[model samples]
Target: MSKRAVILAAGVGQRLQLAADAPAPKCLLRFDGRTLLERHLRLLRAVGVEDVVIVVGYEHQQIADELDRLDWTPRPTLILNPQYRQGSVVSVAAAESALCAGGDVLLMDADVLYDVRMLAALVADDSADRLLLDAGFEAGDEPVKLCLRDGRPVELRKKVADGLRYDHVGESVGFFRFTQASATRLAQIVRQYAQTQRGGEPHEEAVRDLLLESPERFACADVTGLPWLEIDFPVDVIRAREVVLPQLHPLL
Candidate 1:
C-alpha cells in the first residue's frame, strides 16, 4: 500500500534563535545548499513516498515561498495552522484530514537533520506501528525518550520517571509510522487536545497515551551510531553543518 507523510512545521522554533532573540523557522535551516524541508522532500521521494503534507505557521509564507523556488514534481500540500504558538498538538490536529485518510501514514518532526539512512530504515520497516530510537542520544530532558519492556514499547515521554522499570531506553528520532487504523486513532486523540484548548501539551502526550494503552501494537527500530541532530538550539546548527552533515553520507 502507498504511504503518506505529514511534517509538523508550524512551531516558531523559539529555542532555535539565529541572532539575539530572532526565532527563525527551523525547517528553513540550510545545509549542503538545501533547506531541511527540501532535504526531507528529496529523501522521502527517494524512499518512494511522494504524497506529502506539511503544517506551516510562524512565518508560513516563507515556507510557501521556499516551495515556490523548488521545481520539485508533484509539489507537497501545505496545511496552515494559525495557532502554532499554542502547542504542537494543534499542528498535528490540523493535519487530521491527511492523517485520517485511511492510508498508512508517517509523522515526523521538521527540525531534525539526519542521515538519509535513518529515513530509509523507517520506510523499509514492516511494523504496523513504528518509532525510531537511538541509544546514543545525549542525556537530557530535552529529547523525547522511548522506553521498552521485553522488546515492546511500554512508555514514551520527555521525562521518564526515575524508577520506571524498562529493559532499555533510547531517544526518539521524532519519526513515526502508524497503520491506517492506528493513524485514525492518533488523530482523534490530538483533535481532542486541540479542541479542548490544552495549549501546553505537546503532541507527544497524545502519542504516549496511545502507546501506554496498547503497547502490543508498537515496535521500535534502532538506529544507534547514526548521525542525526534535532535542530533545536544554535549549537545544533553549527554541529549539523560541521559534524552531522559529513556523517549522514560518509562515502560521498
Candidate 2:
C-alpha cells in the first residue's frame, strides 16, 4: 500500500526556444539553482511518496545523467519513452506501464510550477479520481474551459462559446492523485488512443473524450485557491522563475 508518482517529461517543449540550445530539457531548466524535477521530487518525498517514476524524452539522456548524479540513496525509477515525440499521452502510457501493476499513482506534468502545499493537500485528500481545477485570473485559449455542474466538473472543453466568460485559471497544473483502479482506467484510455495513432492529441483531450464517452470514470477535486503555473512558452519561463524560484530555493 505505497504511494507513487509518475512525472511525464518527454515532450520536446517546442515553445521553449531556449531548450534548443540549453544543456537539458525544459524540466531541467534551473530555477533558483535547482532543477524543476529536483524540486518536484523533494515535494513528492515530503508527502510520503517514496516511489517515483519519471518518463523522459527530448534530451532524455541529460535527464538520466542528472538523476544519476543525485545521491538520493533510494532513487526513483526512470522510464524512457522512445516515442516521446508523439505526445504527452504516449509519455503517460510509458510511465503507467512502468508502475507497479496494482498500486496507486500520482501523475504530474513536468513543466508545471506550484506550491508544495497544493501537493500536500492532494496527498491527504481521498478521491477516486481527482482533477485540480484552477480558478484563473484570465480567460484565454491557454487554459481549458472548465464546465461545472453542481460544483463538479461535468465537461472540460478547449474553448467556450464566444462572449461566454468564466474565470479560467489556466491549463492543468499538471498534477493528479489517483488510485490504481483510476490509473488503470486512464492508462487504458491512453493506450487505446496511442495504438490507434490518435496519441498526438492533448493529454486532456483523451481524458475529456473518455468522460464524454463514459461519464462515470472521472471526478473533480477542488483546488480553487492553490497558486499554480504552467510553463509552456517563453513568457511562462519568467512567470515560472517568479513563482517557483522563491518557494523552492530554501528547500533546495
Candidate 3:
C-alpha cells in the first residue's frame, strides 16, 4: 500500500481562540513543547508515510514558516485552500490531485493529537477504505457520530436525531484511510459536491455521500482505548495536555 497523508489545517479555529485566547492557527498551538502539526508529521513519518500534503489557508504563511524551520527528510507539500473560510471540505477538495496520485491515502484533521499506535493499527488493517472509530464515544453535536451495525458503520452524521436508536455507535476520530481507487472516487465526489453544494458542510458529508453510493466499500476500524484528542476548545487542550499526552508518551 502507498503511504501518503493529507492533513486539513485550514480552519481559523475560532472556538479555540474564544476559549483559550489562542493567537495562531490551532495546529500551531504548542503543547508538551511541540506543535500539533509537528507531532502529526513526526507520527506520520514514523509510520512509514513517505509523501504528505497539508492543506493550509488560515495563517498559511505561519505554517509554511514552521515547515521551513523543520528538517523533514521528505518535506511535505502544502496546498492553499482559497475557500478555507467557507469549510473544511474545501481543503480536502484542494488536495484532490495529490490524493489521487498515491496508492493509499491517509486523511487527517490537523487539530487531532493521537498516539502513533492508533494509526499503526489502522495501517496494519487490510481494508481498502477505513474510518477510525472511538467506541468510548462522547455524545455531542460537535463530533461526527457513527452508527454501527454488525461491526460496520451504517450511518455517519454530526447530529443524529434519535441518538438512542443505534445499539452500537461510536465517535469518528477524524482520521481515515482510502485505497487508491477510493481516493480517486473521493476526489471526484468532492469536486462534484463543491460545484453543487454550498460551503460550510463538513468534509465527512462528502465521505457519507461516497458511502451511500456503495456502502460496502468502506469499513470501520475500532480504535477504542487509544489515546487521542481533538483540540477544538480550550478545555480540550487542557485534557490533551493532562490526559492524552501522558498516555501517548509511552507509545512515542
Candidate 4:
C-alpha cells in the first residue's frame, strides 16, 4: 500500500501577521533557517511518506513559487482551495481526490513545528484512524480539545468550557492518520457537511462528528513528550524557537 500525506496550508494566518511587517502565509514563515513548510515536507519524507498533496489558497502563488525553487524528490501536488477564507474544512474537502488514492493518508496543519518522532509514532501505530494528542497541553478557548476514554477519543471540541468538564482530556495537535477506508468516508462526510452548512465549519469538528457517530473507528496516541508547537500567534513562534526547537535536537 502507498503512503500519502495532505498538508492544509491555505489560511491567511491573520494572527501571526500582527508580529511581522510583511508576513507570508503561515506555512512559509521561517523558523531557524528553514520554512515551516520545508520542515513539514522533509519530516514527512523522512517518515517514508511517498506522496504529498498540499492545499493552497491564501497567497497561493507565493507557495507555488517556493515549491518551484525546491529540488526535493517526490514533488508535492498542489490543490487549490478557492474557499480558504470560509473554513479549514474546505481545504480538506478540496484534497478529497488525493485522499482517496488508496493509501494511509496523513493530514496535518501547516503552521505546526514538530519533531519527526511524532510522525514516526503516528505512522508506526496500526490503527485504522488515529489522532495525535498532547496530554501536557495548556488550555485555551481556541485549541481543539479531546476527551479520551481508555486511550481512545470519546469527544473532541474547541470550546474551553466544554472541555474543562473532562478529567481525561488532551489537546489536539492538528495531526491525523487515516486509513484509506476512513479517508474515503471522511471525504464523503465533508462533502455532505459542505452541502448542509454553507461554510465556516472546522475540519476538526467534522472529524469529531465522525468519531461520535462511530466511536469504534478512532484511537488516540499520547505524544506528550515529543517537542511540537502550533504557531498561531507571535508568542507561539517564540515558543517554537526557544522551547520546541531546542528539544527537537538532531531532527532540526
Best-to-worst order by lDDT is: 1, 4, 3, 2
**Which lDDT tens digits does candidate 2 get at residues 1-252?**
567888888888878777344646778877777778887888887777878888887788888888887766468788988998787888877766754367777888888777777787677655455667666546776777666554445566667656643443334456776777767777888888889878787777766765555455445556666666778888888877776456542462
Off by over 4 Å in 2: 161-171, 210-219, 247-252
Ten residues in sequence with the least summed lDDT for candidate 1? 16-25
The predictions' CA RMSDs to the true structure, in order, are 1.9, 2.9, 2.1, 2.0
The local distance difference test score of each candidate is 0.87, 0.71, 0.82, 0.83
Q: All candidates' TM-scores? A: 0.95, 0.87, 0.93, 0.93
- What local lDDT score does residue 51 receive in model 4, on the 0 to 100 scale? 92
Instruction: Give the poorly placed runs of model 3, Cα more than 4 Å off.
Output: 18-22, 161-166, 250-252
Residue 68's lDDT in candidate 1: 93
Error in Å for residue 34 of model 3? 0.9
User: How high is the lDDT of residue 231 in model 4?
Assistant: 92
Error of 4 at 59 (Å): 0.6
In terms of TM-score, the best-performing candidate is: 1
Q: List runs of model 1 lying over 4 Å from the truth.
A: 20-23, 250-252
Across residues 85-179, which tens digit of lDDT does each residue of candidate 1 receive?
Answer: 88898899999999998778989899998887887788776666888999988888798989899998877898988788899889989999888
Candidate 4 lDDT by residue in tens digits, 85-177: 988888888998987888889989999999998998788866568888888987778778888766667778887443343557888889989
Q: How high is the lDDT of residue 100 in model 1? A: 92
> Model 3 over residues 92-195: C-alpha lDDT tens digits?
88998887896888889999888998778668765668888888977777778888766656787887765445667889889888888888998998887677
